[model samples]
Target: MRRKVRNYILIVISMVTGTVSFAQTEIENPFGLVYRDAITENLPGKVNIQPVTYTLNGIEIAANVYTPANYDPDKKFPAIVVAHPNGGVKEQVAGLYAQLLAEQGYISITADAAYQGASGGTPRNVDIPHNRIEDIHGMADFIIQYEGVDSERIGLLGICGGGGYSLKAAQSDKRFRAVATLSMFNSGVVRRNGFRNSQVNTIQERLKKASDARAQEAAGGEVIYAADNAIPTEEAELAKIPYDLYREGYIYYGNTHKHPNSTFRYTMSSLLYLMTFDASTNMNLINQPLLMMAGSKADTYYMTDEAYRKVTNAKDKELFLIESATHIQTYYVPEYVSQAMEKLNVFFGKYINSEA
Candidate 1:
């Protein structure tokens, strides 16, 4: 199974090198390098987003915490721990959301998933199904230990892959009072298939790649990875949108996005774990305060709806749709972000603030 996963990764690498081009097309991202309305425009708080490290599963994980200017250490405040997407680090959209959420007086921490970003881990981006789940718990643990954090008032906000983990965390651990995901990706399903299950047609072809990857690894060939957003020239209109997001993701996390040592991609082995993992497998088990938000126009809209229907035990659940906001726009747009923050503050306030 591992070998099969590795071979799928090789295909990603091959595409990057143009050895085997999937689509000989290059699409431009509408968000592009210059977004006119930046976060600085909306962030009026004394934002103190700083880097910190904490031990998790014996690994010293790296993270950044965004404390709103409204923060008052004299009063222990509620905190929201944010998780990045698969193949993403602390600085991507996750951090952006964290900072915005912080401006509302919630302490938010965005961390490097194990084996990615500046955190200490070997076999980078290996994509172990279990490790990602544990990373959520690790962040939870870090927040509670902080001197000024109101441990019982803690909530979680996960973006993409991080979103799946948040749901998993609330299901298994009773610690989080609430959980939310933005443009959540069922990392497992996406990897096993492709965008909208487009690559799920042939099992034989997949198996062959697995066998080939095992052989290639045995030969000590360097592992290759898929470059973000290399949609074929012939891809459908919807597919082109995600490709644009990938391109924008690279720019945000790769360059303009702050926090040093972060990256937009992970190791090739991450492909192996991703192929078999699915957070939706036990959706009915999560029973907590749940807020599932997505752009009305996102490719990932189905997963959010699917997850919302399955969590049989959730005490309170709400599905929010942002009008005109696509998956990528929600990541960087202040108008969309402010709307999300407003909803989130209301949700967290019902749970976290009401208690005080």
Candidate 2:
């Protein structure tokens, strides 16, 4: 099984390289968005998308903002800051939800994190926890100041790894009135303990390698990366992956929803900081209204469950489960996405929408 998975990964690497080469020309959407019914043009009187860029802590962030139909900049409107998953860009799941929320009459903004996607950062693909958390905060900083946005009605929606960061960001960032997560992935815990604690015995060993990677970077040596290998070529090999999150994630990020900017790799030195961080820690700091959703059958659901249980001080905190859906399914599957959007609309409406 291990050997098959490895072989499959090798195939994935070659395919990804080829996909990146022709992505710009082959993609049907003008904006390079891969999701269903993505915005093709900025039509007036409908949900419109605007590509925007802003500097965040010396790094430029690439972002997309969605406005509701017949949007008037003179009138106040509630806003949401949507954060993409690890290795995901603004054109994927994050943008999907942002557009969906806009259809529900809320202004939404989704941005590529620094050092990843199209955001400007040196030594790209760095996945430190603090930086990701700041990305969510930066999104809020920019969105609240956008035209037609009511600063006080700002909410947050983080998907997958972004969901975990949203928890940490909303912990002390009182600017967000409502906070939500979909298929939350606790990156720090997974990095330190491995998915489902699969690498428990190798914790210290991995830490040493991360330290070595950092030392090599200090000496200006070659940059080392983790998870930069190929993925399965056959369905049988993909099924061999022990976790549903990984098995489906490969298909979602590597094939059906492949984007040139998306990648599974992160700087090896990043693990030095990633291993020490814990998204579930300081959970009590999130005093805002909270809503967390995950697939009932998702292998990654445990992380969301654990984190949700820790939000003792959060107001009206709720844990929603999308039955029969897996982690990656919530990203693009129409049925699962509709369920999530329905719940999000109600939750965000009650907390952030002025009409509620």
Candidate 3:
């Protein structure tokens, strides 16, 4: 009985550490996207990647631009700017979707926000709402001027937290001819109310803590943050943990899809701004075509649903759901991703090319 108990504990530990059968691939690229269908290296004579850097508010934002096979600077093409999740960098799912869209002949770009990823900024991982919104606008500013891009036909695709920011960006930056979001997560909502409103009663307390964090930063003190949970390596303990969102997120962002610059934590001081912002507040301002997608089984599906309903002014709109897929699964799971890409292709094609 003692031996059996010990073996069971070990199994739980492995699960907690994300050392299970699915996450066993050897890390290949510094980007650390090890999923089965991940495109780690650029394919010769096909999709080409250009590492780019541009200044945004005196900070250099790092980005990757993917051009399709047989790209010609002489031929105009519709462009798309992809926004990464809140805790994510441009090199993960955002990059993946941008590359796949390029495969279908659209020029796509994904960039690290000013204070995150390979981008330059102080007070690292500060995830304020306005900054993320500006990041999307900045991507539009850059990609609109790229060679062969049709500025009037530029589109936007935001994933997870990026999705929320993209919506806010589209509210005023009408340069985006069409806007789309995948697995939309309302960062402001989750940050303010807590995931699933679990911390609704503690809102004032958390706000006070955020206020103190800001004061500390003002005094040049150490940064304070949330979401620094240590990775668990025990299967029993891991299995006991609930919330598939956090569990699978750890497996992806922290393990299989880990990148050197992809830490998900954000400054606790950001809550001062995050808790009061609402990405969907001015949904009526988005007067262009819009597409919002979420996994039907995602715990965060309510966000997409709520936001989509408020987009009453979109010239055309859709809220697509990937059946049987959870929030994190849609990030890299081949079938779910393919479904999203297919829908995006048709949506962008119809709207972006309507004038041409």
Clashes of each: 2, 6, 7
Which ranking of candidates, highest lDDT first? 2, 3, 1
Q: Which ten residues in a row have the lowest lDDT in candidate 2?
A: 1-10
User: Clashes in model 1: which pairs?
Assistant: 4-210, 23-232
lDDT tens per residue, model 2, 1-356: 01111111112223233231112223367676778777878777889889999999999999999999969999999999999999999999999999999999999999999999999998989999999999999998999899999998999999999999999999989999999999999999999999999988999999999999999999999999987838664666775788778877887787777788999999999999999988999999999999999998899999999999999898889999998888988998889999999999999989999745
TM-score of 1: 0.78
**Number of clashes found in candidate 1:** 2
lDDT of 1 by residue, 97-155 (tens): 77777767888887887777778786555566688889888988888877578888889
In model 2, the clashing pairs are 8-231, 8-232, 8-233, 9-230, 9-231, 9-232
- Model 2 segments beyond 4 Å from truth? 1-27
Candidate 3: count of backbone clashes, pairs at least 3 residues apart or interchain = 7
| Residue ranges of candidate 1 with Cα displaced over 4 Å | 1-45, 202-204, 207-264
Q: Pick by TM-score: which candidate is best?
A: 2
Task: Give the winner by lDDT: 1 or 2.
Answer: 2
CA-lDDT, candidates in order: 0.69, 0.88, 0.84
The TM-scores, one per candidate, come to 0.78, 0.92, 0.91
What's every prediction's RMSD, in angstroms?
9.9, 7.2, 6.6
lDDT of 2: 0.88
Indicate the residue-level lDDT of 17 in model 2.
Answer: 31
